[model samples]
Target: MKKKAIVLLGNKGKKYEYTRHNFGWLVGDLLSEKMDLFFRNEYTYSFAEKRIDEGFIYIVKPMTFMNLSGQPLKLFVKHKKIELENILVICDDVDLDFGRMKMRPFGGTGGHNGLASIVREVGTNQFPRLRLGIGRGKYGMVDHVLGTFSKPEKELLPSLLSKATDAIRDFFILDWQELMLKYNTKVSV
Candidate 1:
């Protein structure tokens, strides 16, 4: 059976639970609940795995800080022997509007430190990624990415995450082209 991984990027700890940068962790929580999967703490990450048809899908959250996310991923991929193409990274994108997402087969980091680390550690930009929009707010870039969501954005978060998880589940079942065609859009929520 094939093995695939969904690498969710976010900082660990309760303090960051509701922050914009922790969006990937929030989505992972929702996806875990929907799939009835529980994460197990590893040395450098937390992960949950489930069998789907003839394959296994591993949902991973790197325990390292957001900027060092790729460190855990590099180790995990080496240990699991999972190919780069079979790993899908999910992360927040400050440039996009809230409720929007872009799914790409390969791309540059777009100034996201987490993605930059991944490209550096993994030695390539040729990996699938799902960029969730967190809309740059009035604050500076660092503050905005690390800040909490506004009232209205918090209200719409659930719907956006639901669509994101839907796309994640599809990643294991559908081809990359098909998943991109179906999920790359600005949701009007």
Candidate 2:
């Protein structure tokens, strides 16, 4: 099936709004604002919908904790009747440098509890994903992922967020492989 929906992996509470762990969620929020879509709580997620040339592209932020993100997603896909292959997950990756990103057609979660949960629930890791770089923290991995951005990172976020939003918009118009190739190596200014 063609990729048709987007699942942004992030925590939901206001406490997590600006935290590194919330990159994917923040992107979803930004995209919603830009597109004038308001997400409503439903079927275990904060969900919104938009119709492009092809069909409805869902914007979902799982209401569950990051580690259990899949619960909502599993419910979401069943509710929307969307196949796992037709969804794209956007998540933060501590493995890459800030401002850098990678897009993959399918892969392991690389220890991300959120991705792992989704994989287990969905019974596959073959779905598309966009991993936004947050860089490894000198403090600690756990601390890093939970912490808010630094001054420099905060300064750079607008540009990064813009690029990410654009990439997601492309998800509706381009094939997964083509979107991955176009975004994987491109660093945001």
**What would the per-residue lDDT of candidate 1 be over residues 66-175, giving only the tens digit for each residue?**
99988999999898889999999999998898899989989999999999999999999999999999988886988988888989999999899999998887887788
Residue 160 of model 1, lDDT score: 93
Candidate 2 has an lDDT of 0.88
Write the residue-wise lDDT of candidate 2 on 18-38 in tens digits: 999999988888899998998
Cα error, candidate 1, residue 11 (Å): 0.5
**TM-scores, one per candidate:** 0.96, 0.94
How accurate locally is residue 48 in candidate 2, as Cα lDDT from 0 to 100? Answer: 91
The list of candidate 2 runs beyond 4 A from truth reads 1-3
**Residue 102, model 1: Cα distance from true site in angstroms:** 0.3
Alpha-carbon lDDT, every model: 0.91, 0.88
